[model samples]
Target: MERWPALELASTIRHDGDGGVTDDLATVQGTTRWIRAQSDLPAGHAPAGDIAADEELRTEIVALRRAVRALFARAVSPAPPSPADARRLMPADQALAHLNAVAAREPVAPQMDWPLDGAPVTRLLSAEDDPKVRFLAALARAAVEFLSGPQRTRLRACTAPRCVRYFVQSHGRQEWCKPSCGNRARAARHYRRQRTAADGGPAPGGPS
Candidate 1:
């Protein structure tokens, strides 16, 4: 068995860490609680505990949670990273933790109530060939991988001001966390929108 992946997964699960866990790995108590709360309808589920009303979303959430948990299991294992595995899953390890953090609920059933609590993620995380689940699992799997030199360079980040998010920064002049951030930066420099002859000088190229 390993350690970090489980811890990383636990960090992603905000619901659990605050209150601590009992038989944490055995049962997804915090994730389930979070799911129930998010998917519950104010007028119904919360009021009457109606699982049938929100079955789909709950199922999807559970499946995603399970898939992510399994990914964590695979990542932090003591086994060495194999060349074939690296080729297939060329991604930054930190991204795995990030993605797992965002694995909130997704609806799958029409309605839900006292839905049977079984294995978390099912077919996809298991041996099944479900395309969508397979896709998500693959992404999770990649996060724990090591890429080639070209990929590492392409996927690196910039130390530019307010730009810490990872991205394909291979292009020589790349900076800024996101285009929106850059746009706002440029806009902030502007004094005003447009200037008429009566107002003052031209729009001043709207600051760079």
Candidate 2:
């Protein structure tokens, strides 16, 4: 399976009910822990151990997350970007280009191994240190690969209330990220219908 740690990194923020957001990566310690936890998650082949998080590193992480989020927003939205949005997207565009460049420079080759019964397997030959910047660069490359691949069309932003995350839709009927999110969305719709009825207004999607 392809690893896309940048997606997880981008999901560190959650929507608040009051038009705000909560940051899971709010602290340097939190950022360090999150990066370390990546190795434990399924499909996460990132190296184990905590990332170094000085003030400068923390700022870089924040900026990387912002760039990832902005790129995702542009990809997921149907509308074309306005002039302002176009300008705002410049940094993200540059970041993604840099990531692709880094990954391109890494050595990759196919080799036969006993583990695969003599089958040739492709591997990343670069064994670089886990500097904070390099770690984030790895994630950025994964994100770029995923977003550019065929699976990009399957990407969906979760519509669950107070949840800000991206998910790959496995089926045509799937919408929300999880069962709980679907339940909450359904209940909210029902409640809105009841309120509209009580107010003698047209029910949503019913009549004009």
Candidate 3:
């Protein structure tokens, strides 16, 4: 699947498989590892090998992630936000402001490169000298772009039990982030039906 920096950031907080949430950016080392693992980020956005994350950088990145996730919650609208941070989501207005502020930290201009043997490519040229600033700004900019793009309409919070993911629906009926989540949800429903039958309640899908 195609990767989006903003989506990737939001996904840092996910199910830990033990029926609890785990934050991938919970520590400086973890944050550094996460940043390094994002090899698919656009050029100029990915940090160099020597640029390890510090406490300040980790805090900034986590803050940006909070705003992105809050905006993602808004994008999904009436649907409940991811259970991981739903109760603590930043307000939509505050999140929007924070995202814009972070995105503006690095000034960038589109530079077009045309070669005789290949198609023209456009890349951003940033005025910011600090690599850390550039990285954070790039992430914020990606979130801004994603929120304003058509794909925002397809964003949905996974409803499967123990799942806390937000995924772009590939099909009209897509309800889970992946097939594993779908299978888990189905099994959960089956278990609930069996329990209800044992309790002498109405059968699954029957009149209450």
Candidate 4:
């Protein structure tokens, strides 16, 4: 499955097997590592190998992530949002405004590139010298593009026990983010059924 940067940003806050949430961007070092791992970022937008994240950069990226996750929650309307940050998600309108503002921070122009033996491709050319601005702008733009695209309709929050992630449903029966989440959810359901039967209640799927 193709990983969307916006979705990845929202997934930074997820379940840590011990029933707690782990934040991938919790500190400067972690933020730097996360930025370096985003190989999918467009050319000229990703920072150089030696780039290190500062407090300011980390805060900015975390704020952008907040906005992105807020919009992701809206995208999966009626369905519950990720339990990690659902209680503190920015308002939908504010999130939209923030995303738009951040995306406009770095102005870009289309630059077509064609190698002698390859097909032509167009990429955004940014004149912004600040890597921070370019990086944040790229993330915001990705969120904007993803929210406005057809894939938004497939967005869903993982329903597995202790899971706190959003995912794009790849098929009709995909209820969880991955096979592991599916397994967890099924196990939880079975446990619930056993408990209910032990309590002298009707078995699941049987008449009450």
Per-model TM-score on C-alpha atoms: 0.26, 0.76, 0.95, 0.94
lDDT of the candidates, in the order given: 0.35, 0.65, 0.90, 0.88
**Candidate 2 C-alpha lDDT tens digits along 1-208:** 3445766777787665565677767888877777787773322223537565667767766776766667776666773322213345546567676556644543334343356456554444444455554566566667677778776777767776666667667787787767877998899899999999999999999987
Checking candidate 4 for backbone clashes, the offending pairs are none
TM-score of 4: 0.94
Query: What are the clashing pairs of model 2?
Result: none
lDDT of 3 at 104: 94
For TM-score, candidate 2 versus 3, the one ahead is: 3
Candidate 4: lDDT of 17? 91
Number of the top-ranking candidate, with TM-score as the measure: 3
Best candidate according to lDDT: 3
Alpha-carbon runs more than 4 Å astray in model 2: 1-3, 16-20, 40-46, 79-95, 98-117
User: Between 1 and 3, whose TM-score is larger?
Assistant: 3
C-alpha-based local distance difference test score of model 1: 0.35
Q: After superposition, how far is residue 180 of candidate 4 from its true place, in Å?
A: 1.2
lDDT of 4: 0.88
lDDT string for model 4 (1-208, tens) is 6888888888899998998999999999999998878778655454545557899989998999999999888888888898888899999999999999999999999899999999998888888988778888988888888999999999999999999999988897899999999999999999999999999999899889
Q: Which is better, 1 or 4, measured by TM-score?
A: 4
Encode model 3's per-residue lDDT on 68-144: one tens digit a residue.
Answer: 99999999989899998999999999999999999999999899999999999988888889988888888888888
Minimum summed lDDT over a 10-residue window in model 3 is located at: 42-51
